[model samples]
Target: MNAAKPTASLFQRPAWVALFAFTAAFAWGWAYPLIKLGFAEFGIGRDMTGSKMLFAGIRFCLSGLIILTIARLTGRSFSLKEDGRKSVVGSCLFLLLFALLNTTLHYAAFYIGLSYSLGSRASILNSLSVFALVLLACAFYKSDKLIFRKVLGCVTGFLGIMALNLGGEESGAFTLMGDGLIIANALCGAFAGLMTRGVNKRVDVFVGTGYSLSVGGALLVIPGLMMGGTLHNVTPWGIVILALLIGISTIGFTLYNKLLTCNPMGKVAIWNSLIPVVGAVTSCMCLGETFYSKYALAAVLAATGIYIINKGKK
Candidate 1:
């Protein structure tokens, strides 16, 4: 008889999970500078709201189509079945709303706030999404544990964010409105992440992403049209931005979903604390921004926190 294939030991699984999470976070980090670049090229603030909306809409629609095609080609079943269709539909709706809030408010806040704050500061503040999710998970879903390791992880991550913030140069006006908008963006992202956990149980992650991006992108069209952004003036750079967005949505979410199959959501989220550090580093490299000592400190803290959180957790 042929020898049985060796199954992966428990020790092997966490390593693989951590690897996947790190890769996902890296790709997501790269996307931040790309977004800023796109905004600069497209004259984000100068562009009519309608134009921005239309630009976002087209990108997401294309992203959805691409994912759908990939799903079909891979022979992954796309049907929700009658019983789960309603849940899928509801999840899609929430996703659309989440997308709208994230794309509109988050970008708006970041751009506006960037003008007032230093890049380091903005990057740190952006990392607040992790904390927001932790709170939301505790209050609404009862999904996260407030254990010592988790608390330490949160604190360590927050410190890393602060280090990044303190390290960069200030640019724009620091208005209360800008601060509030950024906070709102963090809240929306937290809610979206939490919602994805619930939704993924019912539908494929790609399907959920496709539906959400498509519907959300479509919804932006009406507002875009109202805001005077027609289809005529979109530049090549705009197209590039849209493409990146789609890529992030498909690759980032798909990997995240895959990781979830083998790990707890909270554990996975802890890795996300690395995003700000990655973002700051990438931004410095690509945009010629200064790299500060605080960034190094933040990275160390984030790394230590991840170790504490994931160590020995099966």
Candidate 2:
């Protein structure tokens, strides 16, 4: 008989779960504006696709190394024998595939898509990943079945996302490189959530996350460099922004992945609706961008959706 899968005792606590989830959301929300700032500070233009990829690759790769180093110090084994199903090479290959889908392809689409899309539209479309996770979890996880409350909560949260775009100057214009890719990035996030849960069951959550980010990030750097990507005219502020982004990935992904292992997917995912709301409000505050009255409404809607999802829990 197989032994039970181990879980992080601390993450199972309600307070810690709430804290980490909110922190992750806030960090991700802040990343929108920060990324824009990084580009400006480093003199990377909208058309510098390779540079964008390289920037993201460096951030994630460093974050992964940080996680791995911490995990090693904490005595987590880097071995794949725990699964007993795949050979060492096979396990590496498995993780490589996960890294590809979860990090490389996902963020590649995201950085490129952001170049072609408006920030407001990107915020709304990217938050759609929350809904995707809720639905996908139902399909894959036996515990996360579909229900009226789940549907209602999702609709409400999604309305919050849509609310942010109301009265905005964004046109209905769409492109495969812009809108389509952002939507695809959202879907990648949804799928990655599911994959995180599975990986956690077999390996240490931090280890899996570390591998995914580092390996996937390296893949981006190779092609990015080949395409002549460069972080030119980088200033001190740019370096600081890059470091903060690395910290964001390290903290946000580590805690979020840990939360996934211990909580219901729908309940955990519902909070993601707040990301765009936070992104919109933060963009205004940090980027000297326009603030819309609809932002307040969006926050309330997102909060309400999270309450409903958690309140109706069995």
Candidate 3:
């Protein structure tokens, strides 16, 4: 008889999981600078909320379609039959709600906030999502209780966030349109992270993510168009930038979803600390933004917090 096959993919291995998580974080880090560059290339201005929405919509919508197409080719079913006695319509409604929370509101807030904030500062602030995820996971998952270490970690991390206001263009007070909206984005993202665990139990991660992106993106596009949104200074380079953004969404979300499905939420998410560091450094380097001393302090604190959280309970 032939030997039994291992059946597990490399991604299932702990080391591989860590590697993929880092890679996903690194790719997302680049997105901050690239997005700013994209804005400039397409002639998108800070006040052009409509155009911003439309641009983000196209990137996510195309990402969804590409992911779905790949899933189909790999023979993954798109059925929600496993989601229990809920009708197909009910399942779809749930998905739409998820899409709204996951993609539409999430990116809508992000794009708007980024327009008003510096890429470096915005990236660091976005770490709010990571901290939110830890707490949310504690609330939702019995396995992810808030240990002393976790609490300290969160406190330390929040200090890093508070430090953001001490330097740079910010005047140490939150702006309603800028910082508030980004915090809103972080809340949406935290909820989405929790929701993905439940989603993966019913449907393939790729399928759920695709529908969320596509439908939510379409929702953004409609409002954007109604608001007279239009892309300006479209060029080959702009198209390339858009394509890169799409790839970032596709690859980053897919890997993240898979990791969340397979690992403890806190374990998987603690690595997100790397995001602000990568994002801040890359944004300064790529966008020529000033790297303030406070930014480095924030990154260090954030990294230290993550280390404590990941150290695990004795």
Candidate 4:
């Protein structure tokens, strides 16, 4: 009578998990275009880091609030209880730290990076998290050791990723916001990924997610407003796009992190390597950018690399 075991077993099915992963990844991929579009719709200038962070703050804060509400109203354990009453205090403390690292730093870097770079280029560069995670995991966890197969997979994936930038256009955008900040975003994600493991062990995920996002959003919003940030000319379409952004953050994070809970990190993250490819393709179509023949080839390489990495898993 292992009730939880069956749920775990169901999630363990590779096909089911992969399907879920793809759906969430697809939702996330749309963010590149939506954000670029949102910037236009909301009158957010390219150099307006304050406005950019304000928008991000709103997106994450609302998403977190909605997610936490859903989980709580549905009778899920949305607060820290397993570790007793005293643990709630500690849980709140952990959430503050997590919010600072995960949402505040990660999105501050991401928004600033996006402001300076094209969505397509940012998409490609932001996914360096996969490679960063491989290194960090190998260094921190004995269980996630590196082998020839893993190395080969990483190389193949990275090569394909780099190939996306082979076109002169992609290469030309390399700058602080283009590559450096995106890499920083990736590193922040990797750092948060490690912290998530500890958070899951000690706190209710819904509560942590809610607290961190709310706190982080407030933090960003304060500074942004002080810096003369204001969202202007919001039309109906702007509301729709902002709502979509919130949906993506809430649903995408829930599904992706749930997958990481039920499956191995490599299994979850390898599939995520496709985010950049998906983002690039989506951006070209929606952002009025031209697509090149080499982009298709790069997508194939990235997909193949994901398969190779997953296949190498024991």
Highest-lDDT candidate = 3
For every model in order, what is the number of clashing pairs?
8, 0, 0, 0
Query: Which one wins by TM-score: 3 or 4?
Result: 3
TM-score of 2: 0.89
Error of 3 at 292 (Å): 0.4
True lDDT of residue 129, candidate 1: 78
Instruction: Summarize candidate 2's per-residue lDDT along 1-314 as a digit string, tens digits.
Output: 99988766787777777788888988888888888888888888888988999998999999999999999999997766467255666666767777988899999998888777656556666877887788889888888778877778778877876675567354435578887898899988889988876676557778999999998899889888999999998788999999999999999999888898888877677667668777777777787766556656766786776677667465
Model 1: lDDT equals: 0.63
lDDT of 3 by residue, 88-155 (tens): 66666777878998999999999998877877888888898888999999988898888898899999
TM-scores, in order shown? 0.76, 0.89, 0.94, 0.89
* Model 3 lDDT, full chain set: 0.86
Worst 10 residues of 4 by lDDT: 2-11
Off by over 4 Å in 4: 1-9, 81-93, 169-171
Kindly list the per-residue Cα lDDT of model 1 for residues 121-158, writing each as its tens digit.
45555667776666566666655566787677767766
| Clashing residue pairs, backbone N/CA/C < 3 A, model 1 | 50-224, 115-171, 115-172, 116-172, 116-173, 118-169, 120-165, 121-165
